[model samples]
Target: MFGLGPAAKSLREQEEQAITVPASKLLLRAVLNLVVAWFVFDEARGPMAWIVVQFKPSLATSVESSDTVNVVMNLLYYGPVALLIAWFFGRMGRWPLVWRRYGRPLVRRVVDAIGSRSGAGTPGKAPTGAKAQGEVVVDPWWAFRPLVGHGGLALLDQETAAGRVGDVDHQRLNRALECVRDYPDRLAALLDAVREHGAAACAHPSGTRDLPGRHSGRHDLLLRQVRLGSAEDVPKNPAAYRGVDLAIDPALLGTSLLAVGPAGTGKTRRLARPLAEALCLQALAGTAVVVVVGAADADLGPAEWYDVVVAPGDPASRYGLDLYGGARRLEEAVARLADALLPEELAPRAESARQALQQVVVPYTEAYGRPPGLRELALLLRGEPVAWDALREALRAGGGLTDHQYELAQRERMHGQVDDPGALLADRLSLLDRPALAASFNRTSERGGGERGGGRGAGRPGAELPLFAMHALDHPLRVRIAVPEHSHPEAARIIARLAVGQFLYAASTRQDRSLFAGLVVDDASAVIDVHSVRSLQRLRGAHAGAALLLRTLMDLPESLRTPLFGAVGGRMAFPGIAPWDGKLFAEAWGTVWVDERDVTRAPDTSGGIIKRSWRAVRTILAGERAQTESVTTRRVERRRWSPSDLAQVLPGGHAVLSLTAVDGTPVPPLLLDLQG
Candidate 1:
């Protein structure tokens, strides 16, 4: 049901009816069976049969020994008939359970025999111990109603009966089932893909990584957990999270995460890569929407691994990004655009920038019945007198302005056209008008058709690919946008910011919060800003989260450090971080009370010279000094992780991590061995 949406409710009800029975009816069946056996015994006990029986009879009973023996013999003959009757009526729910227990062993034996004939079951094993036990095999019928709740296995039986899943496909399924027997999540994913797609689940996204040799980690995407690594068996970790399968999940990530590490740390390998993989699989399963923003050089996954891959410079991939994010209200679109383009330094006075955008956005949208693209918006915000003349003429031609509104628009042009805030916005907007990003922000200004993302939101007629509109986040869309940060640094920053702003704004307003919305940025130095941090903090109540990876906290101004710390519920410190950066982490994790012991020695006050000589002689001879001493034990406050410990003491290939679930469950800072 995680991804199944409205259909999940109906499916759930059907499964409940199919798999369960009422407790009262079950109790009644048990009582009735006993009564039936007693009446049968009364009929059978005519003293015509004999077997082993007590020679001494009970005083309470009137029946003789020969009659009791007759009952036992008759009961043996009638047992099969009575059991068949109960199988059909009294214990309908019991058969499926019985099949699960007995049928599995039977199937295992048959498969083993088949394998032995083929010379594949020749491996040696101990015959008398637990190692001799057979595998827990897949029972498709038994698993149908309880696990793999999606439409995966739902159609297999029908297809099998119709001869659609052939002998080869049946064997294929059996082998697949053997691989995923312990992972129900993977089983559902596989069967669902084969039903909808006719391909293996790992191969569905155009690349195969969920296979054992391909992906080197344990993933339970059904529970929304991907094991990052094992926590080190050390005292720094609380017993609950210590030396176990440490992980990142919706609860921990729902509040957002800030991973601070230098280049060699396993931040990408341990954190971002696994989370992205889970989100991609979830998208296929209809459980999540994940937008991954990384540099063109980053090896996140392959191109076919995503539903939409927006690589602007790559001609083979031709998707455009929506400028307005498909907002209905003019003000909402304007605000989102302004929030994205405004410089981080001017956040405190952002209202002015918003006003500047609102003025241009309202007039331009009124004239065209659609919001302006980045190029058009940049023209308006640039305070260009010629651009203003063109816009006013278009508005007058459309008759979208009233006498009072027209007067206000005129004054706005005359006064703030060449002002600071609007000029700043114009400069920021101009960054997107570059050549490297020619394929992006091509959302055409056409009403209702803006969502089509092809020509409606497309570029260059016949060759235009659909634009990755922000509204797509409303569904379980898996999108990967690779910004060419190395070649075009500033524009990359803007694109990263745009993706972040769009995700937060669109996710906040989603009517369906069932899908977990996630944003992953590989190198977040260019992305984090004041408003984003603030917006991310407020995301706790929404159905969204983000993972921002940075080399250090110094990239942000001093004012934003605490806010960045507060915005995210999960924090990770990789080895090789600077002591100054570690200081903030030390402060964030705070302190813990620990026992401290102190000892004080009393000086000898015995008879003068003689005692002093004796002590010196003993100390010199025995290498010890004896004295009366006192000890004191008390609890004292100490930093949970010191700055020095975070920076220098952490071993290579390890990090200190802390997490908080979406429901406010906290995990203390603990060390984890990434290589493990």
Candidate 2:
């Protein structure tokens, strides 16, 4: 106390003197101004007095007397005016002392709370008494409580840095989060606080930079709003990374990706690699299902037929092909599948083992003009099992049979030829004595059988029409029956309709994998009819996502476009080598169409002469850019170049990608590999 005695006394004296100084001066100024104003406007004054006298001569004399009295009274008015001035000075004096003691430290705390960094990054504290424009002061606890209620929000106030973390009624904040009707209103207070405190001190950055906005946790989720032209131009190589190709990250948001290109643009070949990869992934995971649906069953023919006899080990296990162990099991499963999925009348014919005897017995009797011997017919009916070995042996014997005898036999029948007449005759003469033929003894057995008769509507009776044959065995995963190339467009449409039906049924019936990974229908426009395409509306109802591929944007009829094209969640495009169609597709998908510009030094050449390279451009469903080339000839004998040629000449896969989200957000540059 002694050490501070002299200094403390001096400081107190200075403070008192400083307070009185402003008070004394303001009082003097107020009194002087009031007195001056009163005298100058006195009753006998020069300018105003003359005007009043002239307007009313009689009252002018009387007014002069009253004015003198009023001047005196105005002097009295100066007393209160002086008091007000003193009061204002006194208030101003108090503020300085307060700032020196408590105010400076508060300001320091605020500045320390917020770092120096700007650009709306990081958050910092606002100074005490710092206020945003139009923001009213309210209980800070009210603001803190609502923010905390959002869950996962860290309470970071200016005082937090000063070790003064306060309690917020988190329950209220959580309620707000659960019922956030007006996001802008809900975030208004927080955004105001952020602006005052600066971004560095705020718990979260406002999403907007130029203005205030609330940012979500996902930084990668950009809400970039932009106006897209009919055709948006893209870079040839959007992704700078060479080897690391950008692919559909299955882990991210689900998508409906469309891959479009003209015929022979390597569309199928490009997809084959990914298809194989997808199949491999499914096989390896043992959880995914792969279903291939296409028209001609030739690709699956080996699985249906050869596997029955050879019982071969997994032929292409890497590619996920597993054959059934036995023909009976396969047939039974196929039958079960047909019964469960198809209408009752459309089931495939199931030939019993007893009916197989007609192949040998009828042939001998019909052609040789006699019935096959009883022993031969009996042997054929109750025959030794015709294993692969026996069939191979029969082919080896020179009596018009060999390992490839059946195939050769089929070819001969197709060409209406036969061999070994004598041997067939000997066998046929004895068939008349067989007990099985007793009822129809007079009628000669016909070797060539008519088409199996069954079913109506979808399949006609005795028409020998190709039918969808799906096996219902407990497949390890899923299976898809595809539309064949030879199938009529109508048939393909029906198949697609059935495909959707299958997905819906599976979704409703099975709890496991209820959400299909995705449905990818290629060349959809050519194959799917308007009604069938419209059926896509019910996809989500069926709990399945679908990605459809079309050749051109025009391929989809206007009626179907409104629903099918409009409903897509994402879009991608690839321009192919055709000027007209390619440009149309490009414009439809909103991708920029870049043509080949010859910026060379030819005297006759225009400075920026661009070649009308492609006539048609194809866009993937996702609106990603792809390059398609066209063949243009100067004359009949000129060279013909295809899209493949252009693709090869293109500097880095020669593709452009346009991506738009359901919310109309423009996606940044990305590369979709359409290569094998």
Candidate 3:
């Protein structure tokens, strides 16, 4: 899908076809020649002698009509062969390919003998070295993909025909491409180093280092920014930013972005789709690791851009989620899963829920060597006596348990007797254990693909389906996960929350901080909470980032409104949001010093006799009072974007976007024309 094969084939055919003479032109020439023949053989001079005498004085003699007939026949004898010559010219470009494919095989011995003496000359074949030297650069990125040999040169011709390549870049890229042609494997080694050591792979400059100036090792790529739209000339927008190009690159994304927009305000088209695509390309360049989470129907990007597509909502999905988020310690497992399952109102009981999950999870893992799946955990939490009895029996059968583990397992049998928090946690697990997601959460069924016996499928080898675990992203990989938002809103929320918690846990504990890891929660109403917001504050320092998309500011709790806005560096507000939501955004954007002009007109009071008499006369004549005008200008503090402006003044297909670079530089909010 990425290489230059199709373009090369077109170029090869174009080269073989030397000329393109349309059949209509040939047919017109034939008709005209036939008309000439008719006149030359006509009885009257109906123009035959007149037209012929213009070019040939012999026809003017009119001596011997048979002699004239002989001359006309001689001239038009080769007329049919003219079409033959045109056809040959069109097919001439294929001779080299024909010789290479067919002629070389029949007489290999003779061709080799001739080649041994001619040094480099061949009838239709170009020597490998000369072909490499003839390589013309089509795209600078072609060199990064290492498109070498005749295919590269052929694509150059194709690009010229398409008029997409300029002469300047063509010449400049050729100089860079020559270095790749000289040492093809060297780029492969350098790319390996980049994938291993992050931006430091390009720490030093070499004799032939050529790439975009905006790229460093941390977020290097053939292109720098992925354009989203442009800032328009509007009163709300700063004059300095009007008609300016707006884009988001990895450097800006490194600080994390928060996009707040309703469903159809081009959030998916303008923000999510572009960001996901950019991150996918960066992943291919071996510079970033990305995970995009969205609804099943959201058009974030195509599935092909991702290495693993974990569509938990789609029954035909080939990947399953690791319910425990790859946590090793038993406490870590209980804490992470409990955070995902418990309702927001029950957040105060988080510690109690953890204790309840630990009561069953520790014993289950002690017995089965892996954490409990959704079904097992749900049944255990339901306070079913039979399920607990069986689990306790299984834990006792395993004699490998230590005194503390066995003691904990024995204590599990009394879960119902105590005021267990399992009831609260079990109420939330009902969403995961639904019929639609029967084969989803546990991830052990064959339909769910082969899973290894590890803690929630983290780096589990020999699995047919991939597991969505951030701890396993030591290498560059792009993962896209889709949750069922419409049919199962609550379930989608639980999964979205789980994915975010998993990402935070992994990012906080990752050892190899080289790969710039990023997560995009397209609909984050279920994910962002008091806990996740706190974790997001540390993302900038961790060299990781996230893009949280919310439909409105009201999705966040009242207490979390300011913190959520403060935790992110890049912020956006799509058109048509509520005035209250815009108020929060206005407060977050803060105030700006504006030049306020005030013009007041007051009556000329206490004037001279002439002025008073004139004012009286003018008032009497015009039936109005006379006044003097006064103008005042001063710098005053005002909202950069007022609540009313953000709510109603923003035109359709426009959004207010602000940016923060990875190095902490800020750009004030400006109105972006999404269509532009």
Looking at model 2, residue 224 earns an lDDT score of 13
Off by over 4 Å in 2: 1-244, 251-253, 276-280, 297-476, 487-493, 504-511, 526-543, 570-572, 575-673
Residue by residue across 558-640, what tens digits does model 2's lDDT show? 54454554455444444454454344333345433323322223222222324321111111111223334343323132112
Whichever of 2 and 3 has more lDDT, that candidate is 3
Candidate achieving higher lDDT, 1 or 3: 1
Instruction: Give the per-residue lDDT of model 3 (tens digit) for 1-676.
Output: 1222446635644444423434454344444444444443443333544555678777445446688776774455434444454344323223344445446886897878787876656433334434456677453344444443344345444444454443223333433345455675875554454345422333312111222222122222444457777897555566567788887776687778888877788888878877777676555455567788999989877665666777665656766677875455558857888888876777888887887788787777777667777888888887777887777677768863454465455446546755567776777888877766645566543333234221222222233345555466555667777898998988888888887887777776778776778888888888888889888878788778898888987877788888888888998999988999989889989997765757799887777999899777555433347778786878899999998998888888889999898798888898888885
Runs in model 1 lying further than 4 Å from the true structure? 1-216, 326-328, 407-420, 444-449, 452-465, 597-632
- Tell how far residue 284 is off in model 2, in angstroms: 5.1
The TM-score measured for candidate 1 stands at 0.66
* Per-residue lDDT of candidate 1, residues 559-609 (tens digit): 889888988999899999999999999999999876565779986556789
lDDT of each: 0.69, 0.35, 0.67
TM-score of decoy 3: 0.63
- What stretches of model 3 exceed 4 Å from their correct place? 1-223, 326-330, 400-402, 405-414, 417-419, 443-466, 600-629
